[model samples]
Target chain A: MRIVVDLNRCQGYAQCVPLAPEVLKLNGEEALTYNPNPDDAQRLRVLRAAAACPVQAIIVDQLDLKK
Target chain B: MSSPTNGNALKDKGRIVIVGASLTGLRAAEALRKEGFSGHLTIIGDEPHEPYDRPPLSKQVLKGWVPADHTKLPRMLEVHAEWRLGVAATGLDRAKKVVRLADGDEVPFDRVLLATGVRARQWPNPAQAALEGVYTLRTSNDAARLQAALAAGPRRVLIIGAGFIGSEVASVCRELGLQVTVAERASAPLAGALGEVIGAIAAEMQRDAGVDLRIGVSITALEGDASGHVRRARLSDGSTLEVDVVLASLGSIRNIEWLEGAGLAAGFWGVGCDAGCRAFDIHGIVTDHIFVAGDIARSPHVLFEYQFLSMEHWDNAVLGAEVAAHNMVCEEIERRAHLLVPAFWSAQFGVNIKSVGVPSFGDEIVFTQGSRKERRFVAAYGRRGRIVGAVTCNNGKWLEYYGAQIARSGPFPPHPAGFDLPGDMRVVPAEFPARGVPTAAPDVVLTGHDPSERHAEFRPRAR
Candidate 1:
């Protein structure tokens, strides 16, 4: 799975931080700093982070080897 | 979990894409899961941050009592879905059943929810807006930076636009022991939302709070120092105010530009939707797959004769989200309507101000309980003989009763309510003059422009 974020629209609401700490983290200024790639073990947490976002800026996609 | 192989099973479940990661969007996702929606859920937002509370931005957060980052809203339950953060939905391809992202990616969906909220309207002058000392409060970072500036103890703060946010900012400045000057283009504060009679009381409150309340004046230009820091502000009345910091509480612009070619019923007033939260197209045709909620959702109110109404209140977002969510998954026979009465509250200048119903919708107002002179009162608003709205200052306990009256379409003047009237109980015209240009008393305005102009602007744009 791969995750993508648009920095311009993100207001740093941090809804993704609590849901997936490994993927989404808040910087010193409290801006939404995140990781686009995570281990498979944290897949569920990343999905939950995307769903919990108020501005819905988190996007997760499934990777296909055939494609 | 194994993927569904049955075609009939997959047909029953459909994907839902919600834009604008706002309070309404989050709540709707949660409500969808709770209501047994097992379809693919994808949420997209332009803001990188998660959904947070906005009301606190002007109050506790600005007052330095609470940090802006700490104002995050509490989630009631878990919502399982895909998240698309920090990316904007550039276009809505209805035919393709996909939302085009700014990054060129597309998310396929069977249903879409438009929850893109409003943004702070900035100063007209780009140079003035770029000044270090001039600020506008809307998002968390705005509040955070403003709070830090206020903590530094600026000598004086000049607040332009005496609306709710402006007034609240002034109140916070006073509490912080900093000199504050409030310049209002309107004659009295809150005249836009509450009318002249009630606005007069609010004007008195500000004057008593030691605010340099300047009414009927417009800011001509902002004078900045060598470092581009605001030093003073010049008004149209041939007067200048010396200040180190300035806060512009002009108003907000709805997030509708991205939906330009979406062919949806989206405009400056917001995206038009049916009572069931279904979005409408430019031709006034309702679309079942696309819904709207929060500040961006404009739907008709049964209590207000089905007049399409849009509210920016916090409560409206939660209620509208739940309704939108329920309607998204339920069958037509089981779908519900989003008809919740609007309510909002604000804390400023040591007074707890709360209002129930749409105060601006009323034509006449009456003092139903308490005394306005005492700085505590419950004023009832009526439209065409029916109670439509009510505002309370330090007397919010009576709002529930007034809200019920509004909901039931109760009568005007409400039969005295075991309280003494001003001898004449007749409800008179509220006399809410145009905002921006001052004429008489104070008023809380919902929009920056005059109410009449808003109506004119909300008309369907020519093709």
Candidate 2:
């Protein structure tokens, strides 16, 4: 699965960090870094992280594939 | 082993009814489908609109950056459930396992989820609240009305109670270059959520952003003009201000009235539930069919000394709903506990304030990193030599680090000092107001023991 984060909407809430620590990481105070592609085994964790974002900034490509 | 056909027959068949069609209800509906629950699902809500995002109602929606109607939450999955909008669940008949609606309809269910949530507390005076310009920012309708009022360019906006919602509105008014006066009864802003030490900094932030911050005073009365529009506000300090718009940001009241005679352990605090989100009877006996989540569920946390905590935040609603939904369909062996560490975030005065865990649970605080003078710092809350919570101002990237410490019950005055440590790390009292003191910011409530119960009952199951 591939991940995408809307940098413009990401206000650095960092809610997605702990949920998917292996997939997403925070660089500094407000800068966020994440892996665009993650193993399929991490689908559940990635989906949770995406859903937990307050701003709905995170997007997963798996949903698109299902479409 | 059972054949695949037999397993499929047992997969899903029962009917599930979910109360409260807001964030929690909507998410749980989708999650139930994701959990392979092919049962008949029914979602009931009082609001006419479908599930929509609420955090933006106070920020982006009020600012007109996004319209109120456009805040509808994106459906992550197709939830083929019956939608009963604009009608409220009047009562829950647990004996019959059905939910009574206001429209004289009864929906039977094998399982039920109560996520009624809370509503904003309006002005005490009904007559004043009916005035044209008096507003309370809770629903999308409230935000749309207040946004139009702000767009109309009122001469002055008189905001009562400097809570997070009130403070956010004050910030928006200043950004629009309108005169806004915030009158708070506490000495500092947000003293109810974060202690006075950080609240003092918030008071300065409001003042620095061109808000007429008034502390230690309350709006005694709101006066309306001949046209029945709010025209002036009388303060407790024997002063009056001419204002066109008045917002009563007086916290919220849990939507537990509908569950009054349901025999559930629900009251002024909220519905009492166990760690697994199963509702308890008035006698404190855990029930099997009924469940609760979101802001209305008050379950005890093991990390916080088993005190029932009621958290009203965006994250809590989403997390709690997922937990409730999971337990509603899965077997006992597959069930999980809802032990999510309480967290919340707010954006006001150009500063992003985020907290991990319940800061109100701590008795003392110590600054670990950054500078408070710069309005960028991280403070850790300690209780009995353990880290219970942490709040960061514009330094949310470090939240996960502190949140880990809080989850493990780390020692107070955290070590492994980062490179950006503050010069002085003096431990001081958090200085929270005495319990039962009414404040606008009622973020978290840790209720220990039942306050209303007079007697207890015990029963033993046959071996």
Candidate 3:
């Protein structure tokens, strides 16, 4: 599974970090660091983290799809 | 009208109606389609615009960094649903499974999701509230109007109430170099949400930022000029302030009045729902066809001693909508629980304020880390001996750590993080405002103590 977070839209609420700890992390207060791809075993956790984002900055498996 | 069927009878081929086309409604529609529900979907909204993000309206929009019209929420998936905008849901006929609309229309459905949310409370006096300079920030239009008014350069801006919205607007005024005064009835700003201890810190932040802070006072009356524009505000302490703009940031009101005769467990606190987001009847019996989400959903939390909680935060709305959508389409055994630990964030006075769990449920509080004098700290709230909530001001990097402790119902004064400890670790009263004081306590409400007291009168044959 692949995931991408729009850094500009991300406000570092850190809500996603707790939901997907291994894949996503907050470097400091505002800077967010995350893995772009992960094993399918963590799909549900990644999706939940994506949905819980207040700004909906996280996108899963939509990187290649055209708008 | 057809009778309501058992939960499993209608899975993906039935009609589904969703009331309120905001964040929760839009997310639910997207989730419903993702859950493989190929049914006819209808979304009804009173507002004309499509679903939009509301958080930025007070912060970036008011600051003129972002336009109000550009706050629309991004569409995650293509939801091919019938859209009904600029029309209000007048009533609900549970027996007939139909939603009455204001434009003399009726929409039938096998299942429905109510995400009506809340509206900003208006000034009490109609005439004074109708004045030219009076405004309340809730929708995109309100932000646009207020932004223009601020850009016009009002002589002095008087803001009533010191809630999150009010305080955020005050922050924007100061950033714009406008003269602003905040009048609050509580002992300190944010006393209703974070309690007096943390509220005191917030009060200092506002004052240090050049805000004319006035506590323990309320605006008794608003005097206006002959042109129907607000000029001066009279205070309870016999003082008047000359002002050109007035913002009544007096919190919000739940949008559940239209469901009065619907026989749902709805009242001043909001509509009641179970763990699966199923709406409860007047007799506390869960209904199969109706679900609740967003700010209008009041459900019990296992973490907070199973007390029914109503959370008006972005996280709760999104999480609750997904759960409600899943339950609406799946069988009972395949349903999921909406067990979201309440969380929220506010940016004001150059500080990033964030919190997890229900802060109002805690009786005692202690600053565990960071420096309070510098306005960058983390305070943990404890009830009995368990940590119930934590607030971080400009110290949100530790929010996830504290949130973990709250989810586990960890011990109070939770063993210090082994670093950045405060000089004094003494626990003190949280000092929440007394009941009956109209404050910003709506963000997280522990509705009633007795579960049985939440039920309404069941008049089965009233119609």
Candidate 4:
């Protein structure tokens, strides 16, 4: 699984931080930091955090079977 | 008649129509598509633009950090639906299962989601409100106009109310190096939402930021120039300020007027709904086909003594929309609750305030961490011995912890951990305004509490 957050679109609402702590975290300055790819176990939460984003800055792209 | 969507011709997935194509409506459409519900979908919106994020309209957009039009919410999901933009839903025809649009067109639906949301409350005097410099912040266009006015360097800006939006606008004005005066009728800023105790701390923040904060006073009238632009404002305290810009942050009015004769339990408190987001009829019976979401929804919370909860916060709108969407296509047993642990965040006066749950639901509050003197602390609000709400200033990481406590229904005045507790951790009355105040409380109110509603099962709490 791959997760991507658009730095330009991110408004720092921090709604994503608490939902998937292991996959995403807000630094001391409240700027978003995250693991772009993670194990499948955290897949549901990552997608949820992406959807919960008010700005929809988080984009979780599924891997291509061909790739 | 509109042509049927291609997928609908092959299979019967049913037709779903959504009104109010903003955040909630857009999110709900995404959820429906994600849930594998391929159906005929139609989204009706009164605004010309597509869905957009509103939180930044007061913060970054106003501060010139982001363009007002650039804040449109990204459409992450592939929703193949017909779009009806820039047209209002004038009425609902439930028996015929159709929506009446302003253009005299009726869109049939197997089910519909009412996410009409709310609009900013207009200033009482319509004539004065029509003045060129007078404004209210609720839409992208409103922010754009307000931002342009600020860019012109107004000598002074008069903010009429001290609600969340009002306070944030003042913060932006300060950031722009502009002089701003805040006139709040309550005892303190944010007195209605956060109560007087926390409002005091907010008041100090506004004052320290060089704002002319006026409490316990009301605007008598606004005086405009002959050019039809606002020039000055008169106050009840016998004071007049020559201000170029006037912002009325008085509050919001739910956009449920069209649902009047449609037989849904809708009124000033918004539309009443069940836990699963199913709308209740005018006679108090849950309707399977009609659902409600976003700020216009006032569904009961099981944890908060079954009190109906309505919030204009971003979190609730997204979560509620998803829940309503899920319930629309699923069986009764598969439905879920929109029981989001209501959370919100606001950055103003260099202080980041975050909170979870309904703080206004509590009768008493106590600061569990940090100190008020330092303007950084965590306060817990409790009622009937259970922690109902909490607020944190510059300490949002702890929001999840208190949210759990609120969900657990922990004891109030939480027992001091045997050590490191502040010496003067005293409890105080929340001091919310009396029940009758128009804008003091959130849009949440018991449908039964209203005298006219005969079928509601709620009694107004003694204030």
Which is the leading candidate under DockQ? 2
What is residue B98's positional error in candidate 4, in angstroms? 0.4
Name the candidate, 3 or 4, with the larger TM-score value: 3
Off-target runs (Cα >4 Å) in candidate 2 are A1-67, B1-11, B437-463
Q: Lowest-scoring 10 consecutive residues by lDDT in candidate 2 chain B?
A: B454-463
Evaluate model 1: give its TM-score. Answer: 0.80
lDDT of 4: 0.82
Ranking by TM-score: 3, 2, 4, 1
Task: Return the top candidate by lDDT.
Answer: 3
Report how large a share of the reference interface contacts model 3 reproduces: 0.01
| Candidate ranking (DockQ, best to worst) | 2, 4, 3, 1
Count of backbone collisions within predicted model 3: 0
Summing lDDT over every window of 10 consecutive residues in candidate 3 chain B, give the lowest-scoring window: B437-446
lDDT of 1 by residue, B409-440 (tens): 98886656675444445577886875343222
Over the stretch B65-166, how does candidate 3's per-residue lDDT look in tens digits? 667776666666888999999999999999989999999999999999999999999998999999999999999899999999999999999999998999
Candidate 2 TM-score, true structure as reference: 0.85
Docking class of 1: incorrect
The best-first sequence of candidates by lDDT reads 3, 2, 4, 1
Backbone clash pairs for candidate 3 read none
Interface RMSD of 1: 14.8
DockQ each candidate and list the results: 0.03, 0.10, 0.07, 0.08
